[model samples]
Target: MSGTRRLFAELAILGGLILVLAALGPFGSYATPLGPRLLHWALYLVTGYAFFRPVIAAGSALARQMGMSRLVAIAVACVLGAFPTNVIFVFAAAGPAWRSVTASDLAGAYLQTLIVGATVTIVQLLAERGAVPASPAPPTPALPDPQPAAAADATEQEVAPALLDQLPPHLRGPILCLENEDHYVRVHTLHGSALVLIRMRDAVAQLEGQGERVHRSWWVARRAVAGAVRQDRNWKLRLIDGREVPVARASVADLRVLGWLGDAPPAA
Candidate 1:
């Protein structure tokens, strides 16, 4: 899914939580009128999302470019973002007078928003991760792996993935795999490789049953695999073009489950 659709899906998930929270009425809000309490929680939660998410997402992207952990960046952004978001929440909690907000009260409110922000961030991240299955183009009748003689027929019938359209005409042939290089992902096609100014995750998400990420920085098309190479406890996918893409140990079981590893042998 594109970012906008993903955002809507995430907000819909949040909407469900909002309904439950409003019904339960936490934080001593049970005494308030149901209508006002629902509105208050919605404003507080949604505004907090608007405030923290952009900064956190940007910080995570910058961190990746800077060769830093996104978790560290998210922690920093969530903590720092809490201050301003808390201001909005404090003002929204109109029962407490502005003048009555003591330094200790401000501190407590800050702490509360920080915790809530972190929780919401975790939920949103999980939502995006869970949304992967919703991507990929609609399923079509599976075809046999391409062969040299059938290449022309396959090309004529195959609906090109949107991602390949970004490549140059000459390089828009069979996709082998993707390799990440800092800010860009190098698209390895059967014709030749070229760098595309798109993130590896986004590129993989755009693929329509052509490939999947078998490693943190690599995505491989199953049909392009020549064989698997074992290096002691490590594993690598040897492609038809003689390129070896490292396979993450964690992804080994998934590959085995999908029949990428012939007969579901042990990962190691």
Candidate 2:
């Protein structure tokens, strides 16, 4: 599906789920009338869609910088993002009720939002991870005359097998990085990315000496690394193609040992 259409579909599904779930009275203890309760939940959904989208984007970027997985990033982002969203909800809906609420009540409200955030994150994660890769294109018809043995030999010698060999031919290019999405691995290249059903270890093995795993769920090509940047206390490798790969804390020494990082990296 197109990115735009997919986004709309996801929003529709999320809205439907929230409405149905709200009917079950997840916020039953709030002590509001039926009309007020319905409006409250409806407003909650609006705030959810508005706030969570940017939070998710920022979280994904932060996760990439922190050498974290997509799932981990979403979970962390939602939990942390609840604090701000809850404040917005109080201002928009509770008003005077919010003013009277104690510190403990505010904390409790954030905790509730955190639970809802986690639930929503899990649903979105499942939808993304369960998606299938597109099928490969059919081969073109062969020419009437067969290729000469010399020509075939030269073609074979020119294209050496690398980790990208597992990807579709269209996606083959200079390796940028690899991302683990649930059970599948996304092989990213200068051209684009493609998903393959392979374990991270096996995929890395196929790369031979070409690339190194920067995190448990991320691998990057040494040649593709253009520079390194430190974000607060974390490190990220900027690729030649403009993509960034996070460097795990445990792997800092490894990068230095591998010459990807100098002996004296600026303290993060």
Candidate 3:
């Protein structure tokens, strides 16, 4: 499935699970009435998911930097995320009463929320690890007649293979862009995206002469830069495959130097 569809499906599953947990009254009784209690639990689940998802993503980046496997990084991130998520819940669920609560009471509440947070984390890990396979690539049109031997050899020599050599077999192809998220660099191509354990500076270096730095956290292949778009005073690049990459103010000169910022689109 597409990224947007997959996200919606995940949200639906999470919402259903939360609703079931609320109906079961797993905690037995709350100080508030049934209505408020249910709402409180729902809020706890939604807020926890919202806050920790990005935290875990950042953790994944750090883990990559540390040379850890993606799964291990995710596990560590989830464990670390539980503490902060529980703290948020304590105040959210307690509201006005939290100020009067003792340290011991707060600790107890945190412990309880931690268990729920851990459970949700494990569910997410499982879902990610067991992701469905990508669909087959679409058919391409037939190529034209082969070029002369010398010309073909020269074309092959011009295609530098340094970055492609580092990528896994499936991810190898013409690169489209690189997005830095925490400690990991997300490499995008016509085929798909893969997260590599490389800092933004390092990734940009590997693409030298092939791509240009467009943002502090982004690099785009010159060949893949289809056009530019303007949003308010800011600018973004439109990639060949339709991904919109943000262009930093400092890098505006670079794009202009390449003639990419000519006739900027109207702000939306």
Choose the strongest candidate by TM-score.
Answer: 2
- Candidate 2 ranges with C-alpha deviation above 4 Å: 29-34, 68-70, 96-98, 130-169, 180-184, 214-217, 222-238, 244-268
Candidate 1 on 44-163: residue-level lDDT in tens?
A: 778778887776566656554444556677778788888999987786674657767667777877876887688678877776555432222222222235456347325523544566
Runs of candidate 1 with Cα error greater than 4 angstroms are 132-268
> How much is 233 displaced in model 1, in angstroms?
39
Q: Name the top lDDT candidate.
A: 1
Candidate 3 lDDT tens digits, 62-166: 653454555577667766777777777777667788787666766777666666666666656556545543333323211124345446334423563554555
Model 1, TM vs. native:
0.49
TM-score of predicted structure 3: 0.51
**Candidate 2 residue lDDT tens string, 1-268:** 5456557766877778666755676756346655676677777766766667665666667665665676677777887788877778766666767667666767767876666666556555555555545333333222123365456334323443555566666656555578886557877764567788788787777665767888887988666666688878777887666666778889988887676765232221
- Please report how far candidate 2 places residue 126 from its true position, in Å: 3.3
lDDT of each: 0.69, 0.66, 0.65
Q: Report how far residue 51 has shifted in candidate 1, in Å.
A: 0.7
Evaluated at residue 232, the lDDT of candidate 2 is 88
TM-score list, all predictions: 0.49, 0.68, 0.51
How are the candidates ranked when ordered by lDDT, highest leading?
1, 2, 3
